[model samples]
Target: MQSSCRKTIAELGPPKHPVVSARSAGRTRDRSPSPMRGYLIPSPLPTRRTRTFSATVRASEGPIYKGVCKCFCRSKGHGFISPADGGPDIFVHISDIEGEYVPVAGDEVTYKVCTIPPKNEKLQAVEVVITHLAPGTKHETWSGHVISS
Candidate 1:
């Protein structure tokens, strides 16, 4: 039986492989044009380029921001301010308004962002003061009507 199996094997041919012939060897290599070639890719002339984060935020500083008084009422003595830089609206109380300015809607204002403590509440804008009337806004002049930040 072993002799018959060997005779049958001898009649069969060897298996095909990539390295068997020059024609097959050509098929194994990539022939497409590469995008990296023949183009003037800019290299850093001075410093070698490094992996870096491009969208880092500014360093933390005193949270003073320019905003406008959204609403204010002498009776309620509380309102919210819309920040000019598009942050969340901050709560402001009449007591926070220092100097002689009375904040009103559309009044250009400056305030400091403060975090609420203890029981936990929304962030508040403290040291609220009217910076100036918004463009085209008019108000009767009181002494120190506009408070500078």
Candidate 2:
């Protein structure tokens, strides 16, 4: 009876589970539950598109008036040149400048004029590339290759 059972089992071949094969190879068994019952489906998120512009750096006199850059918004015929920085002034927006990266404080940038006087204070940056980056004041040193022990 046992011999017949053994022959029947051999004829049936392997089981349809990865764990069974892994155990036959002297490996530890994994018993984690799977998410095949519609429990772990992932969903996509929404995204937004941003517009770009350009400008040029302009000089100013006030304490916060480090300088200004000119940028255009719609047409070239009309545009406004606003102060880039004013001491204690806090009305600068990221959309006002045009460039691959945002301009850091003390960075020299050029942009296009977007709004002119008697109309609006905002300027649409057509091109906003940094002309001069503030120099690094700190110094660093690195040691040469280490000797084998």
Q: Which candidate wins on lDDT?
A: 1
Task: List residue ranges in candidate 2 displaced over 4 A.
Answer: 1-92, 96-99, 116-126, 137-149
Lowest lDDT sum, 10 consecutive residues, model 2, at 39-48
**What is the C-alpha lDDT profile of model 2 across 1-149, one tens digit per residue?**
13243233234444667455544776656644321221111111100122212112331111222333232212112222344554222223344444343343444555443332233343333334456543542211112232221
lDDT of the structure predicted as candidate 1: 0.54
Each prediction's whole-model lDDT (CA): 0.54, 0.32
- How high is each candidate's TM-score? 0.48, 0.26
Local lDDT at 27 for model 2:
63
lDDT, candidate 2, residue 94? Answer: 41
